[model samples]
Target: MNKRILTALLLAAALVVSLVGCSSQTGGSKPVEDAKTQFKSEMKFYGSTTLAPVISQLSTSFNEHYVTWDKVDSKFDKKDIAIYVSGAGSSAGVKSIIDGVSDFGMVSRKVTDEEKAKIEGYQEFKLGMDALTISVNPKNQLTKLKDSLTTEEIKKIFAGEFKTWNDVDPSLPKTEIVVVTRDIGGGAHEVFQKAIMGDTKVRADVIQAPSMGALVTKIIENENAIGYASYGMVNQNKGKLVPFKVDGIESTSENILNGTYKVSRPLIVLRKGDMLPQEKAFMDYVVSDEGMDVIEKLGFVPNK
Candidate 1:
């Protein structure tokens, strides 16, 4: 072999080896880039009006702080991903997931055995704890009832046994009792019925509102109205409605965390079968410390 030819061959071989080494290094980083791209899209969350605010805030924060790959380096762009949160009630939310209409469903109560039967291999992620508040118009003059109402008294009011405020207590004025309740399918309604009403039936003539917001509105508009709502909603409307003590226990975050609030329920997110990478990431963020901060800030008890 010629000396010049041998030297040229060695140099060419060295260049090819260097190129292969560079390719290996770049290929190793593909997974991280793929993960970023996989999640850079829209996410849909439905159900539980009580959790909608928290989901909305978390979605905003997640989009603002998280970076994604775009064929180059990581970059944070709000437009890269979008999260839409809506509340049609917990049952509807679960139905949305089973029907493939939503990526995630939010529920403020335990998943009933019947709901579980609707779909196979669904998973529940508990995000936080919430308490149902027995709310009344702030201007209500039932001072005795305002201070505290025993479980029996609450049951009586809803059962139509107590037709007037004076029937609850002699100290209270004689006025027609107005009861506001959530629609039958509402998680709040189910919880209220189980926890407070038990086997007792609510009066047939009682006014029923479709959503917590509407129930709150009805309570605020009628001085004699009493209804049950999530503590977060009642806390948000402190001046408009009074969250009365039940059986001498107030529905505060502390009480809920300590198990003293009997009306408390779990706030959960539901998904079917295995979770997509994006869904898992969002669920992880919701249980992370930063996510718990958002939960606590919205007036609910964080699971962690």
Candidate 2:
């Protein structure tokens, strides 16, 4: 072979090796870049009024921090990723997911067998715990009622057997007691019924509110009215509502954590079948240490 021709061939071979090396390095990183950019366009969460505020705050934090692909990039569009949180009731939340109306359903209680039957292979994620607090209007004259009522006495009062305040405690006034309760299908109502009423039905004469906020409003407006709500709701309305001790145990986070609060229930999110990557990511953030911190701040006992 000619010397010049051999040298040219060697140089071409060298250039081909360098090009292959460069391609291998860059091509290997393409998948990593794609993983970083992958995200859901939107996610919809509906259910449990009790879990709404906490999830809503989480949605905000997730959108602000986790949803971003590049935090330092000035052109990164945070609005492209969206999370919608709303609550009708736990039952509604579950139904919404079954009906294909939402990406997730939040419930403040364990999934009922009936609810489980609605969707094949549905899964529940326990995010936190919440104690149901009995509340009355702050102006009610039965001031000692909070400290004195036993579980049996509470059952009697809600059962309509004790029609007047004096019927439960002779020391109290004879004013007709106004019973308030959550409407059927609320997870809070389900938990309250199991924990407080047992086999006894809540009286048909009682006033039923559609949501925790509405129930709180009803209790606050009527001095003679009594109702139950999540501890978080009562805590936020402390001045307007008086939280009662259940079986002499105060509905505190510590009591819930220590297992002394009898009225407590699990807060959960439900999904049917396999979770999408975005849904799994959101759930991951919810159970993370940072997410548990958010749950604790909302007055619920963190699962972690």
Output the number of the lDDT-best candidate. 1
TM-score for all predictions? 0.79, 0.79
How far residue 158's Cα lies from its native spot in candidate 1, in Å, is 1.3
Q: Model 1 over residues 1-304: C-alpha lDDT tens digits? A: 9999999999999999998788777784333455645444677999987877889989888877764423112332334556799987888889998898888898988898888887667888888899888888878888534578888999999889999998988888889999998787688888999999999989989898877788889998999998887787876777888887899998888899887989988999998788755666777888899999888887788888
| Model 1 spans > 4 angstroms off | 1-40, 66-79, 144-146
Number of clashing pairs per prediction, in order: 0, 0
Looking at model 1, residue 202 earns an lDDT score of 92
TM-score of 2: 0.79
**Model 2 Cα lDDT, one tens digit per residue, 1-304:** 9999999999999999998788778783343446546555678889988898889999899878755623413344444557899988888888997898898898888787887988866888898888878778878877654564688888988889999988977888899999988886577888888888889988879888877888889888899999886788877776888888888898888898787888888889988888866567678888999999998887778898
Error of 2 at 50 (Å): 0.8
Clashing residue pairs in candidate 2 are: none
In candidate 2, what residue range of length 10 has the lowest lDDT sum? 69-78
Query: The CA-based lDDT of model 1 is what?
Result: 0.83
